[model samples]
Target chain A: MSVTSTTSQPNYHILSVLVQNRSGVLARVAGLFARRGYNIFSLAVAPTEDDALSRITIVVDVESTPLEQIVKQLFKLIEVVKISELDPRRSVERELLLATVRATCDDRGQVVELANIFEGKILAVGADAITVSLDGHPDKLDDFEELLRGYGIVELQRTGRVALPKLDREARLRAVKGKVV
Target chain B: MKMTGAQALIKALEMEGTEVMFGLPGGCILPAYDPLLDSSIRHILVRHEQGAGHMAEGYAHVTGRPGVAMVTSGPAATNMVTPLCDAYMDSIPMVCITGQVPTSAIGTDAFQECDTVGITRSVTKHNELVMSAQDLPLAIRQAFHIATTGRPGPTLIDIPKDVLQNSMEWHWPTDAEVIDSLPGYRPTMKGHPRMIKEAARLILESERPILYVGGGVLKARAAEALLELAELTNIHVVTTLMARGAFPDSHPLCLGMPGMHGTASAITAMQQSDLLVALGARFDDRITGKVSSFAQQAKIIHVDIDPAEQGKVRRPDVPIVGDCRLVIEEIVKAIRELLATGSTQADTSVWKSRISGWREQFPLSYEPSEPGEALKPQFCLEALRDSAPPDTILVSGVGQHQMWSSQYWRFDKPYTWVNSGGLGTMGFSVPAAIGAKVGRPEATVWAIDGDGCFQMTAQELVTASTERIPVKVAILNNSYLGMVRQWQEMFYEERYSEVYLSPDTPDFVKWAEAMGCVGIRVDSPEEVQPAIDRANSIDDRPVVVDFRVAASEKVFPMVPAGFGNDDLLLPPSQMARKEFLR
Candidate 1:
């Protein structure tokens, strides 16, 4: 995959690293980022279908050093098997965000209507607060969170971004058009 | 069949072809020591854990094998931090096995227990704590594999006490099994043909090109291939400090070393070159001086095994990631094709004359000693070079002595010059010299050390004397931390802060004698050659010769810290102009 041309302003980039599912591998990867003074905007890690391997998705804001250097350093980790830089433009990105917001009698209806508009579900409703969950693109989740803050968010949690490359044009057209053969 | 974890560890080391290890035993490592009694591998008991680590580094530097060191938990493991960092900086292949407390007692702060893996994680290429007896073999195997492959560095395996004592069923696995298991470690051995061709094109088209070789050339055993390319292209070559022996110094096109204290000719040539063909050499701060200005005119073609090092410092116009030997071979082949088709002809007569002019104008020289005056350190080094065998391996500690030795000694072959280049580690010479001697038993080994650095690890001579390693140490006893003193003289307005190593403080001759070594002291200029000859003749035990050289002498053609190579200062006699700037 190609790294996009560097712009004057710093931009966030996502790196998906596949590594051995063993103790201290995550720490080693994180330690490398910390030692190199690279800022990690968000980090998500979990095991893959193969029990022996794990996938770590890290979003870093590039400031000084090139993304090529960061990827090379990640490859230096003995546990890291493969690293793929997911271009935001070419990949489908999603994040799961959960928020507990104050929803008293007056604001309950407004909050519910906003949640419904964002395709969010109410997980639990309490006397003072209601817990709402939404799964969508990172920017969509950010927009939903901004609306929820109007009702006074008591707590907020976000499962960083996970990405998968978009299908080829033929497959996308077939899937979108709902055509067999 | 069943075997104890310690026995399995020993068996695994044997399977990896480990013939020797340097270590010091303590309470936690005692279990591993017991199994060593029946093992075939020779263990050299070092005075300190640090000594053990450096000795292993020395051995690894000479032979392209991963040197092994074993130390106990806590303080013993802590002592290995210096050498671990040293090995990491230089990318030396080494495996350090540290003993740990029982697995159950790992977090409880048991006696002589510490976070071995945590402590070494940043410094080592990789580290593992073996929590189970069954995992010991695989961990040991993985450690060796990781330590020796791709840009090689030190790896540590911490075996808990109980893990070593516990017994388990064991079977020796074939090489294929080990190979299949390590999926994450695949080192690219072949260069991309396109990149190789592009590099060759750059080399052929450039008017002023220089082959900037580094330690990776020696690591990849690509010296012959590199020399062939240099000769074919009719280009001058500069070997970095870590790459002293990578190219023969006697070659007509060879520009000795280029960097902080590099030869003026080499530095100037690099600064003036239009293209820099950097093979396996990182543009280290010491070599580059000021990053932005270093080789500003040169278009770089960097070929290294580690992709991380490609753009880590200076960006290369053509970056090829592969083994040095393979890449050089491909480049040579591509050049041959180009020559066959008459695509390009490398005619660098103008560049050659400019470099030769610099070589003649600023030759490496020292001030002659006045009648009956104290001997100069450079004179002692020159004498040693003349007296010693052609194959003698010269290892040195960091300081003025290291720079002087690198400047004066004419290394004819690869693997003959060993020193701590990246880390600038003091006290590295004595133990490293012993290790080099151990690795190359037929070749005479000498540790040319400074007085201040010699004092730091002089006790390792006991191990050398007792073990009959027969490595000679020549101490340039200038009564000061000479390199620092020189810097202080030049930059710090001659404020010599704590740099003076007093003459009467634990006399080196008496100390060497106490350590059961042949101690010889040379005071005058006349005694330098005789002392080196006498020391060279002794083969039964290690020798320490204290040469009281002139303290005021300084290494010249120095690019002060943060200065460009073009701004090098020549010696007073060689300086026609005060400040020589490009």
Candidate 2:
């Protein structure tokens, strides 16, 4: 199944805001989202090779009409360099991980069997326990892990959402603070 | 020829075959930068000295070569600390060149000077401050040699500003002998062959024999030999976190990574096995659940390139050191002799069945609900993996994702998965992905970063779009510093103070677009895969998928540091079941 952008407007336009590196920069940016009642799907800060700048990737549901207004207000922050709407139409990637699973005695065999099928691993074991680890596309893992639900699952550790784009010359970083390297 | 210290430094680095140097220009290093203009080495000017240090680490990892970084003294040198410590923890080969105050002014606290030597002594494998211009060439040569050799780690050379501009005749020491004065540096290869033979005999005789592998395999570039041994012995293999992907994950006998987060079957297998051949793995606490219970029934054969690692933790029945590749080759020859003579024991089905029994006993599980109000990080990871190319190189920042990626990423090829495994460096992924993308332009690279860690070096995203490096970054953003928060929750009574991430939408989509990049935001579980697919659709221009995930989520099956693997903390769901089901 492919991700097809639908005519029905996306509930939220995924936005990544590039801002200057400064203390409380996240607070100011997050403040804007909070004021607008935009629930951030996920937010993280990463450094641009330029130390003075940091990129904040935020996933949130927003109505189609006022999205631009949100972008403009984000630019109002002194630390914000620019704002970009990530169109899934282009290239990107995401991933998460699961720690070991401890299946109940009765369900252990089937759980282990399912883990092998999903390319997951058995990390630890006790007289009556086991932990399995797996990483992949979330949906595929979800499908595989669903089979193991019958077995006792010890715990789940997940990374919050983090992402980046594909490469193209037009989008090549031209300058940092308008200064070319 | 007599030349300025800056010119000599450039010439020395050039001779060392350094193609790129990451650094930010500043006062003390100004003179050095002036000479850099005429050098052929490609200098990347970072915005901050810290980025340069980390970029050096990133470069070293991708290229499998020592990376060089230059900075001025004081804060510049201090700013480089995180990356230096990062390199030290990961055992990466890096050479840091920091400009110190004038040699005579060292203790005076001269303008823009700090105790570079004192500050870096603990973090670096070795630190030297060149007091004489005549020693510049020799120092550079030795630094490169030392950084890349024997348990590779970061090394630093603090050159005073006066030394950088000093004029002296350069007599490059063409051949500097290995220093013998260094303590515990010797790597021995001439171990008893009889012992190796005995080890092989143990392997053949034991009904349950397993190979415990580590990153030393990669460090030794012994993939071929490892594959050969695994195939010949028909032994199952388990890797440590640092040893992830040492053997192709697709190998049926491969048990994946083992430790606190390790698979139950692998741990049980190790416990039940009669013989365990430890390759390059140091038996860190993470892997050896409880030292006393670890491999309780097994006799271990520890093979490594470092002699010190032999008895550092669990003493080996057979300790072979020198080169992992060479030792493995020798072991193969001895084992072959045993088989040729038909003197060894036969198949190990009993042991395999025992391991199978353990595997059958415990298994990993996850919920299948489509992302809605609560978006699971696993959903995001699976989506990213499904959407990326088969050969994509996955890198990760340290924390839950780092462990999760090791467990979930399913890396079948060598070098496809890169992480700060030994060091667990938080800000490793983004810069490392950039370097990986740069080194292997045709390969797809993704950084599986945590929200807290992504923030640590998020600025590297600018490097991605600016350098036109196509590296996909999928952030598993549980707003809290998930790993630390887990520690607090489990051990510290969940007194979550600084752990909670204040919620907010930073408009990342508009930011990427503004930076002339692409961004995708997926809040619902249903949109996760679609967003990943859409992001992968574009071959050019970087994209970001910000998954709005649940907070208060803890990484499960954690064996808190210092605790044995058996001390694993079961998730709330499991705990709930135990309380309710009975």
For model 2 chain A, where is the 10-residue window of minimal lDDT? Answer: A1-10
User: What TM-score does chain B of candidate 2 reach?
Assistant: 0.92
Among all candidates shown, the one with the greatest DockQ: 1
List, residue by residue over B206-272, the lDDT tens digit for candidate 2: 8888899887777676777888898989999997776676788878888877778776667657766
Q: TM-score, chain A, per candidate?
A: 0.88, 0.66
TM-scores for every predicted model? 0.95, 0.71
Q: State the lDDT of candidate 1 residue by residue for B1-582, as single tens digits.
A: 798999988888988999999999998888899889999999999999999999999999988888999999999999999999999999999999999998888899899989989889999998999888788888888889889988899999999999999998887766677777777888888998999999989899999998999999999999999889988888999999999988899999888999998988888889888999999999998889899889899999999999898989999999999999999999999999998998876678878887888887788888889998878999999899999887999999999999999999998899999999988899999989988888998999999999989988989999998888999999999999999999999999999999988976778899999999999999998787788889999999999999998889999879999887777888988777534323
For candidate 1, give the DockQ.
Answer: 0.71
At residue B177, what lDDT does model 1 achieve?
A: 72
Residue B10 miss distance in model 1 (angstroms): 0.4
Model 1 off-target regions past 4 Å? Answer: A1-10, A102-105, A125-127, A173-181, B578-582
Candidates in order have lDDT scores of 0.89, 0.73
| DockQ scores of the candidates | 0.71, 0.01
